[model samples]
Target chain A: MSSYHLDHLQHLESEAIHVMREVAGEFERPALLFSGGKDSICLLRLAEKAFRPAEIPMPFLNIETGHEFPELIDFRDRRAKQLGAKLIIRTVDDAIARGFATPKPGIVSRNQLQTPVLLGAIEEFKFDCCIGGARRDEEKARAKERFFSFRDSFGQWDPKNQRPEIWNLYNARLNQGENMRVFPLSNWTEMDVWEYIKKEQLEVPTIYFSHERDCFRRGGQWLPVPPAHTGATTPDPYAGARPTEKEPVKRLVVRVRTIADMISTGMIESKVHSFDDIITEISAARVTERGSRADDKASEAAMEDRKKAGYF
Target chain B: MSATISHSRPPVSHPVDILRFNTCGSVDDGKSTLIGRLLYDSKSLMEDQIEALERSADITGGGQINLANLTDGLRAEREQGITIDVAYRYFATPRRKFIIADTPGHVQYTRNMVTGASAANLSIVLIDARLGVIEQSRRHTCIASLLRIPHLVVAVNKMDLVDWSEERFIEICDQFNEFLPRLDIKDVKFIPMSALNGDNLVDPSVHTPWYVGPTLLGHLETVHIGSDYNLNGFRFPVQWVNRPNNPTDRQLHDFRGFSGQIAGGIVRVGQKVMALPGGQTSTVKEIWTLDGPLPEAFCPQSVTLVLEHDIDISRGNMIIGLDQLPGTGMDLHAQVCWMHQRPLQRGKKYFLKHTSNTVQAMVTEIDHRINMATLVPEPAPAELVLNDIGEIRIRTAKPLVYDGYATNRLTGSFILIEQGTNATVAAGMLLPSEQLVRPESGDYVI
Candidate 1:
């Protein structure tokens, strides 16, 4: 007999899958929030389970900060093609070149620059809802977020005017120029994501498998040495972006299981080499996956603050 | 294994053993601190998080990490040192992962607790050993029973303060056991523990050697929640009508599928299902997951089902297995936990949100309001006051396909949405159809 009840795991999965299908069925044009991270990967698998036999239905929407790892571009395309889902790349570079997104000098992180790019893509495609794999347990600010998070025309999440999600029933209704940021995996814990990945044998980026890479230490976090966080004098090709140096570099044997943009994803000094070894290390680990995420390590409600600023 | 019998084992296998439960009780009962002890002792705390805890130690609350802050994060809540919102925390053992809904114990936040406990399979009610079982404990436990939580655990916390007295523990245990039968809870496990000293959380303490029960976390990790789902019946509520209207694409253009997450049972391709509201029988032709085709799709898997016959169906319509069908009626009898500041009075109309369907409903009658202290009915009061748990009859505009909350959680529960603000004010668990009374608001004035 199949040892399956709609318990927490199944319940979370069901809710996510259901929400994913609702997006496909309800909206004319929709896109996914892909960051080449664990949460987005989990969202990819769920999207796969949601629209299987056909395709993921929607296209991959990446709000490129122009600061992402070069390897992510390859991994993102490879997986998108593997599932035959459409890949839609909208970059902060385009936003800055078109005067949509702007960035300040001496700042290497394009985390804040992605908002205009995202909002531009939404307006371009007239996307009604953007499906993301954000979990409420990831941070405290997220703890207060609604599943069907509302975003205005400017793509700002007004937490005070959030809709209520009662009894697994979601109100996905929206008006024109307004969009819903649906988090199907809102109820899932980080542990549930890993276990589901393992159980489903889902493929993720190789960087997540404890890969060895060249990194330099800055403020206790590892940056990919030279090219990363390079304070620039002139305008970058991707418009309005200028990589700046904060301090002198200190090289280390750094490895980050989860990869974000090269400028922000903090690398940990881990010697664990294989997926099996990583799992073992994670089993006894006390810190959260986002702990090493240099971007989130900035403030207490960093994830929340970014999310409210329309950063999925 | 037989060793893992859950609350009233249903002899069925649930997909995953992982359980999401809530811990709710009054402030002094140490709900937050006890939960912190559970996670800390279970070794679920991450290195970075622990470090942060060490760095940002509570200044006003004794310079120690206010364990409650781990779950409670709202600014108003932190400033007042009270949990005003539902905070979720997750942890895992090699066997299973657990997510806890650490809800507020304040009277004004019963809605938050109800929201958290809505998805919970089991509920852990914490009680202060010195205070015994209080009103909050009874209210939460009663709601747990009403919500059809299969299992319950009552941690007699602060045992250290009470000197680990076995007699005192037994007396409270007996008091709980006496009321458990009345609340309709199928299973209960009692344990004595001190959250501050970390007794019987991860390891059974030597001080409480008289207690042979598993530690709080031990019971949580091993307790079977495998049979709590409604696998016998099949109910699917259509969330939306999937019609890919790309006229250029010949194959995709005409596809009309009623998409939804199956709420119960296994639906195989070619199986017959009776559509609700219209009672039309259709055969399943395809099951589309985000990935692709499936031979069989069961409850909780959000799969878009394609039926052979293109019958009339839309959102809010439910499709059920022809074999084990559900009861359809306009009158719903349910036990509701009043959450709003305004009392639930007779002759009032409220929005009833059941599953994916939302309809206007009027309270038919307030059968009885439960007296928490005595666990007895106060007959029929003038109104169902705030935090009042009572049975009520409701009438909706259209018929709804539902089962008893005891049978199917997805179909059997609903919320009362305030008509004015559209705020969800009450969470309800439906009783059987016969016991339900269709109250007419016109018959009685507020």
Candidate 2:
């Protein structure tokens, strides 16, 4: 006997690492989607393993929502600087100014704003593939996505029309002006990610850990530090049904469950502050991470619809 | 974390606790409704997903939250009241995470079942109570066994439709029991439930007081999947050559290493290993994980292995233990399940995708067709058609390093590609035969 136990994590890592190397071997110019989230952090580490003892040659690309948590921005910059790797930030705000993307007037969400920014970045960088940390277990629409998801020049994804990839071979063959989205962590689960972060001892943004923050109520749940801008709702600007004139704006101490753009993701009352606490809380919690994603919460096929529109 | 798996659980839970499993059974088996119950009862569902279920509940006879719609997400599926394609759904619990691939029950989508079960460690084969044991159910079990899923959960759904009759459940179980001995299956658990009313899903129902097994969720969480992975033999297919091309980077200037994930076994530093095809030998210099140096890197792990010698190895070639070096040959006799619409004719060329390598392959001979439904040998079949399981002789343009599927799934199983269109035509599990019967011939196809 080899005397080694069945190492599922190691197995998942190799699967991901093999995929990362595939991206490097197959594509001409590849970039990784780095959002400073735990999943992206795991992706960063896998990239390191893919080409360790050497620097990650691929650049870390980010579609800055403009409504990013300030803490995440600082961490993103610092980490990129530490790795000595290229950091490409394409802002949705800039795209909005360029007429590439336009949200409804006075809309709070900058999420829909990310698509044009991402596509614009792909165009500017001429990247053939953009590696992302999208796990299939995250959502139904995401589950239907292939490992080597493709996009047209216009950056549209037609789920009905996708090429079949067999065996371990990914046919990254694309025509001119076409690009691919590679998700190495597609097979991994949420718990797998936290485990990897701990094993690798990766330095992630602090928002992942539970922390006290001022919040209001929304949709029978809490919202930590609600965005100053409001979405297209009037009955209750945010904190749900209010009294005739106004109810006291009580900002209660709350912690975010999933840290998306402030406009989309909501918060919960969780004292589980550290990674350990978060794991425990998640273990007992009945809801999935995306339950709070305003966009996902909006429609059953919202994620899928967004994906078809080049929103990874 | 559960005490049983914690020591094995990688402390850093790879950011997702998602476990992907598949359910293979025909229509009316309540595949969708079962998934609906799991999601609804587990409380992993959101209010909106539930509301969507309610709004379109009329798709089924009654306007209830037709549980099947939970997985049957497509509008076409709702309209036809059938799962046409491979439908995937996501649900999670603190103990673990899950993604279910609800494959269509129709025989036409057998290829989809292959696609679903390829990456899955477990296969949940649901059988309707009214139809105790049918051809579709048998075919599913055969495919699951063929795919080498370590664990099998047989959910006898629609027990309510059968009046929660233990006799019906027992009869189906008895029918399935007859065929178990012919195949290699470790764990098989039978659970009877009514997906409509959500019985024996997340919680055991009071009616089934006679039944004393874990609930569906309980079994899903506690299944002994630790020993399910292929960790016995070491198999590493080099996916890339990691070389930093920066001239200013002196430390990385001369670093040329074969980078790939460890497919099967552990590779320890200074451990003697051999490269296949060329048959060259070398010792492991360093096993590199994402962080830095590691004492060893094992199967299913993605790590770069640096050999002490500059042995010629590249993508598609594998590294294995010197003692457990795999057989190398151009001709292989494998138990293949033909998945193409066109029948698999002898002497026809196709692309064979094995591990990270894709090479030209031709079906040299068709030994016999094993009827997936009957589970019997049609030894004299001239051709294998869609969803047909049979032993076929395949000759590759180049040598392939492989092991028996029973021994190492990662190394044993391979897919056939249609030569002209490059479509994946078939999937095969190898059986030891022919050349292995003779010593020095260097010819084996299974």
Q: Model 1, B121: alpha-carbon shift in Å?
A: 1.6
Best by DockQ: 1
- Note each model's CA RMSD in angstroms: 6.6, 6.1
Estimate every model's Cα lDDT from 0 to 1. 0.74, 0.74
Writing each residue's lDDT as its tens digit, candidate 1 over B75-175 gives: 55666777766777876665566778887787766667777888887898989999998778888898787777888999899998888899999999987
DockQ score, prediction 1 = 0.37
The candidate 2 chain B region of ten consecutive residues with least summed lDDT is B1-10
| Model 2 TM-score, all chains together | 0.84
Task: Residues B47-68, candidate 2: write the lDDT tens digits.
Answer: 5455556656644546655667
Question: For candidate 2, lDDT tens digit of each residue in A1-312?
Answer: 235543446657767777888888778999999988788988988887778777786999999877677888999899888888899988886887889888766666777778888988998989999999988767766766778887888888776555444335576656789999999988776666776777777887877766666655566556555445455564323332222233334555566666677656676766765667666666555456777767786666677778888997
Q: What DockQ do the predictions score, one after another?
A: 0.37, 0.27
Clash totals in order: 28, 39
